[model samples]
Target: MANIPVIAIVDDDEAVRTSLASLVRSIGYEASTYESGIDFLNRQSEDPSCMIVDVQMPVMTGDELQARLVEAGRRFPIIFMTAFPTDAVRQRVLAAGAHCCLSKPTGGDEIIRCLEEAMAGHAAQ
Candidate 1:
């Protein structure tokens, strides 16, 4: 995690991206928003402390993004969020070494909790 603790929120939905960014900022962390996985992959210059990425997106999914990061040797604690969550999805992401998996319509506190857990080197359930 970065000393300043930036939390990157990546999702295809404009509303979701905005809301999570705002909520994360309110809690005293630098929040960056991206509308897609490719956007974050191409645009992010500085590494964030944690990532809140949507599971389902147009071009690339959160799991795929994680895989890319791993291959590139850039590891950030990742929290995967999904509107349509399933046990298989959850298990797969966890197996792939994601920090946490969250359901959409999630509250700010839950996100904070996940972030906290991740930063502490613990995978949140």
Candidate 2:
């Protein structure tokens, strides 16, 4: 459907990216996945969507990518997904305007909830 929201998932891990794509599509939204932040940026579609990005990556960290996006005047919703979550990192991402920071091993329901909230513009500050 044209009205269905699109979600962009950027992660270096093949398994994570593929799994996320499947899960997102299973929940009714369209999902596009990238192997790296640079790949996503280079071939980003013109869609008003939320981003689910891994915090640590080789080419660019999620925070760095977010910073660049902001500096370039691009304001899309972002939800950071990290396995190595830390207090300082969480605070930094929140301060940088991430919709939310989801610690890895988070359940499917929680991920969907985050996506729904982000699409509705109701994600946590």
lDDT of 2 by residue, 1-125 (tens): 88788899999999999999999999888998988878887898574578899999997999998998888788888999999999999999999999999999799999999888887784344
TM-score of each: 0.90, 0.93
- Point out the worst 10-residue segment of candidate 2 by lDDT: 116-125
* Top TM-score hit: 2
- Alpha carbon lDDT of residue 3, candidate 1? 60
| Candidate 2, residue 73: lDDT | 85
Encode model 1's per-residue lDDT on 1-125: one tens digit a residue.
Answer: 45678888999999888888888888888998898888998999677878999999988988898888888888778899999999999999999889889898787788889888898783232
Q: Estimate the overall C-alpha local distance difference test score of candidate 1.
A: 0.87
lDDT against the true structure, each candidate: 0.87, 0.89
Flag clash pairs in model 2. none
